[model samples]
Target: MSYIRGYDPDTLREIVDLRECQERLDEIGPQRSLPALLERVWLLKVLGRLDEALVISEQSVRVARMAGTRKDLLRARILHATVLQARGALPAAMQELTTCAEEAEGAEWSGIAAFALQHRGKVSYDAGDYDEARTDFKRALFLRQDAGAADEQLESTLLAIDAADRRRSRTSVAS
Candidate 1:
């Protein structure tokens, strides 16, 4: 199947029935490239089919490894880490994200690096490490701003707020 370029996931979630979209995608799954598979995996993750998403995410990473375009591999790896995080495998997710962030930095891909850092912050937040989460989120905000990524900036801002709230809550409990 040909990749559906510019298929905005946020818009899709607001409009179409993701299940039907996923069903149509599955029907043509065998014909997919790694990019297409990555898209499908994201949809499955949103649908709470974590097991299926993890399987496809792994396959996407494997295929991208063979293909070896740094950007494509970076995207697949990030997605793999995300699925791991969703499945509550925080340590594995953090490890993969750490590696992905390093690779993105080495390649000078600011967008991926920013996104990886943001995801890292999210994992830290999930683990109740609010200080670390706030630190990473701040760094990600800087990167997103430098890259002119307004959408990412907004997300980082919201996450920073959440991290701050979490930190306050934790501190109050300890007091």
Candidate 2:
């Protein structure tokens, strides 16, 4: 079982009580292993402990760089970019995610590419750039389909696209 539970399997969004996540984090304690660190980072991020999440995410990136494969590094960087996004560093998150997505695509890792694009789309949406977000989400959906991603993953992207479309329509109407 994963360190933390009760989150959207595809989106990683919280669906459980924050107290449960915190308790799980506390139960997990500290571990230097990259997977453990990554789990901790996710939990902390979900718990609104951005500072702690950032620190652990950075550490996980370094660990992945030194000890893991390219795929691992890419995943770590993606999560790190997410932490940056959560911290309101949209530009930095976009830059990192864009690079990661490009690299993953160039490497023919469609699933990884889709993951990066999905997060980048979220960053764009958070920035109120619904057009860009929709574009990214659409591309991500295609990639995920090609990669044979799980149904939940496809559903998440589909939902994201719908949300972006709704927001874009509302923005245009308001303008």
Candidate 3:
């Protein structure tokens, strides 16, 4: 499943439509068909509808748990945490990510672990905890590098770190 992590609302809706078509053809099982829900959640998130996205993501997580697929569950948990973070529920988001990170570690899913850690870093950053954010982002960067993720993603993370540092510097100067 080549699930695109970030897509615009229109593209995400198109993906959801395609998945729905497959589901109608009975090609994907009910328990296994989580991509559509996830796509919808992503669409809502892109639209800045955090409440709707959170509800859908929570449902997706339940479905993923019932499907008993580690990859699906990981994606659901990540999306759910993202929704929580967007809603400013940083503590809850961190808790969810921490659980996901532990699960990834147990399953030796380095990619998923890295993804979870990246979000954990984002939550810390949002909560004004730059030290923890930097630590988490560094760990995520290392894991993603070890997992051989695309250079584009690594570059994006580096840019994010640079932006964060610049913002911190400006804040310090202002204070």
Candidate 4:
């Protein structure tokens, strides 16, 4: 089973049937297959069952650690962070993203690193930490641009950053 990266669920569903994915995951056994669990978690997340997704993602990361695959662990961590962010657990989500970002830097996974940074920035923006948000967003934008991600995604992020900056400026002026 292949795990879906980023937030795209349509492409992910093409690779795995979401309805039977969980049973297939049980068949694969969590002890030996973190990727299977990760895919299940991603499907659950796309279905809007975030609490269930969180549980599965946590289990996936633990399994990845036991299996000694840093890549799998990193993927699970990023997915967990995404769920946390969705649930409004910004502090916990930022912490997870920070760890993922550091690991990605060490592993030379620029795309994943940028994704982590971008999410961290988004959480920061939600938490009203504009300075840190700006820094992270800029770093993410640079990395994503360098990695040749779709221009639309990069543009959306840039627009978010600009909106945040404007919000900060207005608050400062009102103060």
Candidate 5:
């Protein structure tokens, strides 16, 4: 079972219940396994605990490097980049995500590549580069569709594309 439970209705944002997250963390209980660390990092990141998330995310990357597969390492790196993005380190986050996306695509890991592209689109959105964000989101949507991703996943990418379009329009109107 994944740690994430649902999405926020108002924004279609991910919603990690605090109580459930804490319980999951406690259940993990000092385990240094990559999955455990990744879950902790995600829970912490969602809880607005970026400092703790960053530490664990880095650790997860290290463990993935030492013990997991290339895919695992890429996943870990992608999560780490998200923590960086959440913490407002856009440049660093973008760099990491860009590398991860390219590497995953090269390996023909369409699902993983789409995941990276989605997050990279998010980073671009955060940086107010709506054109780039929309481009990435479109590519992500294509990849997800090609990989037969779940409906919810496709919805999320579609929503992101819509959001970028809205933002871009708003910006142009203001100019």
Candidate 6:
């Protein structure tokens, strides 16, 4: 189990200096385990290398599945869904995130559960399911709040909830 604490969603976005992170990743070449692969997958996604991200994402999921651990598999699936969303594969993204959310919740990985729910909320909103989107966003906000997670993540989820609510209202009014 490689150190995954430093590569949360915020940290992954902060790894915008890809050249530096890529170099660091190379230094850990021989030890490229599932955690490491997931890290690289996130960084590659941030760097807009969708194709490479997809490869690493799939590899990480495969490695995690072989590990036979719900925790590892849920995290991998979350990252995979993120990359799929980036690539505009919305249906696949939604599926992966939905499963990841459920598994993470059952595995008691609060952070992953909240993250998956947040993304799934976005996916639902994109799919025009405003009610479901609002439900997911509200649930994610509650989870993050209860978990004492970063306020930014909770705030983002809140904003999504508000947007979904407003959209639903507008749709109803239009009808």
Top lDDT model: 5
Best by TM-score: 5
lDDT-wise, the better of 3 and 4 is 4
Poorly placed runs, candidate 6 (over 4 Å): 1-31, 169-175
User: Candidate 1 has which clashing residue pairs, if any?
Assistant: 1-31
Tens digits of per-residue lDDT for model 6, 61-123:
999999748778888888899898888898999988988888788977788899899888877
Ranking of predictions according to lDDT: 5, 2, 6, 1, 4, 3
> Root-mean-square deviation of each candidate, in angstroms?
5.3, 2.9, 6.0, 6.0, 1.8, 5.2
lDDT of each: 0.75, 0.89, 0.73, 0.74, 0.90, 0.78
- In model 3, the clashing pairs are none
lDDT of 4 by residue, 1-175 (tens): 3343333321111233555655654665554366677776766775567898899888888888888477777888988887888788988999999999998978888788888888888788778877788788788888888788887558656765775687679779988
Q: Weakest 10 consecutive residues, lDDT, candidate 3?
A: 7-16
lDDT of 1 by residue, 1-175 (tens): 3222222221111234665767866775765587688887877777778998899999998999898587889889998998999899999999999999888878877778988988887788778777877777777777777778866355645556565566758777997
Weakest ten-residue segment in model 5 by summed lDDT: 3-12
TM-scores, all candidates, are: 0.79, 0.91, 0.77, 0.71, 0.93, 0.74
* Deviation (Å) of 14 in candidate 6: 10
Give the least accurate 10-residue stretch of model 4, judged by summed lDDT: 5-14
Instruction: List clash counts for every candidate, in order.
Output: 1, 0, 0, 0, 0, 0
lDDT of 3 by residue, 1-175 (tens): 4333432321111123444434433443333358878877766665567787788898999999898498889989998998898888889999999999889978988889988987887888778766677677787788889899998557645654654576567668888
Query: Which residue pairs come into collision in candidate 2?
Result: none
- The pairs that clash in candidate 6 are none
TM-score of candidate 6 on Cα atoms, chains taken together: 0.74
Off by over 4 Å in 3: 1-32, 171-175
Q: Better model by TM-score, 1 or 6?
A: 1
Model 1 CA lDDT for position 39: 83
